[model samples]
Target: MKKVIVLISTYNGENFIREQMDSILMQQDVEIEIHVSDDNSRDNTVNIIKSEYSDKISNLNINKIGTGAAAKNFLQQLMRLSESDTFDYVALSDQDDIWNPRKMIAAVEALEKSNSKMYASNLTIWNNSDNSTQLFKKDFPQKKYDYLFEGGSAGCTYVLTRDIVLELQQIIKNIDYSEWPNFSHDWLLYFLVRNLNEKVFIDGNPYINYRIHDQNVHGHMNTLSVKMIKERTKLFFNGWYHHHALHYKKLLQSNSLEYKILDNFTKSYFSRMGVLLKYNFQLMRDNKKFLMFFFFTMINFKTPKDV
Candidate 1:
């Protein structure tokens, strides 16, 4: 049996943690070892895992000294796993999602069949309030610069080969965490993997139920609501995207085309015109999002804020 290490980051997830744990433990055709990092929950999340799952999970490792940020917690565990070589694959999990019985095995099979180092899949988004479910498709044909704008999928559905994990470990080591912007870990990972020229396979089929609730750190934004528009506008005008763009430029080869385009884009609005003219439609998944990217890049002239 192939060994898989599952890393889960938790934050006050007492309500559904048990269900999530049970689903993970029930995975088929893989030897599972779970590593959980809890962000100092004030609830019984830590207690529940220890009392109920310790015996059930033979190799369970729970660390409760998290910095309260989900990204930091996940990255910290990944950094630690860099020193170990005990698993064939590494998967990221959320504290609230339920996995199918074949999630891990399916990921393993897909990776082997496609000869890909990294994998991400679409998911079924289950809304807690209305009890409605929708298939969130992220299997669009990847464009040239999609990683610069968004992640392929949620991190919960991500599965990485051991080689990819080690590559990420090296990249993580060179990063100055204090200077790093608050980018989603999954997005950053996707960016790094793509920048390394690694082949990533995005599975159209979903193997997990992504539960949406009030306490979710980041939820679905498929529907364009007034609230979503306002939030996106705030992030745009406040220089969040610009900051990420500028920071990411430093991590790329200076002479590469990606670096040049990103460098030009980070300059004044006039400098960005060339990039917009040449790669406008190529930067996003679809023309609709490309229009939004164009509008934001055209109107935003404020200097990127210091991190």
Candidate 2:
């Protein structure tokens, strides 16, 4: 029996929303459902989620929006409380993470034994000032053409698939919020469900106690310095190259043969250079080591996995 809906979203999560609502009401079996959308959190985090989820919660009030507009207004109030109801899954909580009572039963047995419509797990980075734990093992790269430049897909350890959240609510009702790309809302639902291949990657440990406070943004972009890491690495690679050139210009306006061979070999290797464009046409391009690791990752190179 599947009917999960742990969708959360908040702002001032009053001291780890009651240990993430008692590890999700001490999950034992299933039939879960808890939605809380509070962007107006002037602190008590909406009176501790209305004194602890006032009867299986369902609150929304995107105070002064923006955080992907309070996650597209909490996915349009969870698609209007699932209209005439139906919920095989729709998790994406993070009011100060805690999960892992088999994190929604291992993301519903890896999205019902993977045909891959969406699933995510393997996270445990809980450092709350020294109560350490760092697991982060989400391995997926067995390469199905490297899932067309894999980004997003870790919105607080995901698990979606009410038909991929109604096909991301019809791609967020034809998105164009000023031509998008402010990035977030799990990288725009991991760039439209991994470019419609529907993505899935579960391994284990869904417990993500990642409440390393100071109202984390990108979890303290590696304890900044070196000139705020060269101005936050050129504003995080110019907002990841404007959301990877707006998802590779919507995969070359949907003509997609892997973005027409990665946009004709990244526009013929940035119009030629020396050494046969450095070791033969960008190493005979076929995801040439992720386009020379995204060309020293869009110029602002400096690693330690660039935090």
Candidate 3:
């Protein structure tokens, strides 16, 4: 009898929005309501939702910023929801994915049956062009850096407990999304949940059918193992690595209690800002992941002279 609300952020998703909505309405073991925050879709995305699943929707907010900021869109959706305590849990949904009938049931059961404050499950990625399906990733992640370098899991599969939802509302008031435009909403939440020692449940079974296409924002899911070592190396060497680091730092700074706790992690995690910000390969010796520091930048015979 758990009450759950699915927060969906939609763009021009008319092609599959209706089919997805049907699957959402088919979820079991929970009372469900859908609240969509659409980023001013020019197509019939809103009309499709209204016409196809009017009974399934709870709230709809239309935004005109047209920034196509999915993270900000969802963050705002969560903020709007934080004002009330009507629901027991909240799940994230992408407008285009088809949900398994038991998605909500498994998520709620996993959290209630255990001490996990948040829930994320594996999904089968469906390729549109060729119509192929594959596991999002073969392994279940356990490390802190895994959450960073490799996103812990798809954000769309998250079912957050009430406490997690409350903290999100509190911390976001001080966070500026512009600071890290590409910083992932899922990774940010996963980082805090782990660092705060909040119990997290990661179900191994695939629960949703995640869609992958040329236009997907985070479409790196071609294989279970991230075999793109070259791309990963670029991520480390490029300023993106450090930029992401700063993104976490800024969020941590916003919550004093959280920041104080994060201060307890290996100091190297906090001290790499200089190398990251400067993209200084010569300072690789200063970082714990010297190879990564080197690979991310200054990968040649000699490192940059420290300035």
Best by TM-score: 1
Clashes of each: 0, 0, 3
Pairs of residues clashing in candidate 3: 236-296, 237-296, 237-297
Error of 1 at 41 (Å): 1.2
Question: Which is the better candidate, 1 or 2, if ranked by lDDT?
Answer: 1
What overall lDDT goes with each candidate model?
0.83, 0.60, 0.70
Relative to the true structure, candidate 3 reaches a TM of 0.79
lDDT of 1 at 231: 72
Give the C-alpha lDDT of model 3. 0.70
Span of 10 residues, lowest total lDDT, candidate 1: 57-66
**lDDT preference between candidates 2 and 3, better one:** 3
- All candidates in order of TM-score, best leading: 1, 3, 2
Q: List per-candidate RMSD values in Å.
A: 2.0, 17.1, 6.2
Residue lDDT tens for model 3, 1-307: 8889999999998887887888889998899988988999999999988887777788988897764678778888888875455889999999888999999999999998987888987789888888889886523535433443334478898899987888767777787766573567877777767656777788888898898766676654344435445555554444454455555665555455434332322134333343334333322222444445544443432222211
Off by over 4 Å in 2: 5-18, 21-23, 26-86, 92-127, 130-154, 157-159, 165-189, 192-194, 197-210, 213-258, 261-307
Model 2, 162-218: lDDT tens digits are 877876776676665444544456546655676776666655554566666567655
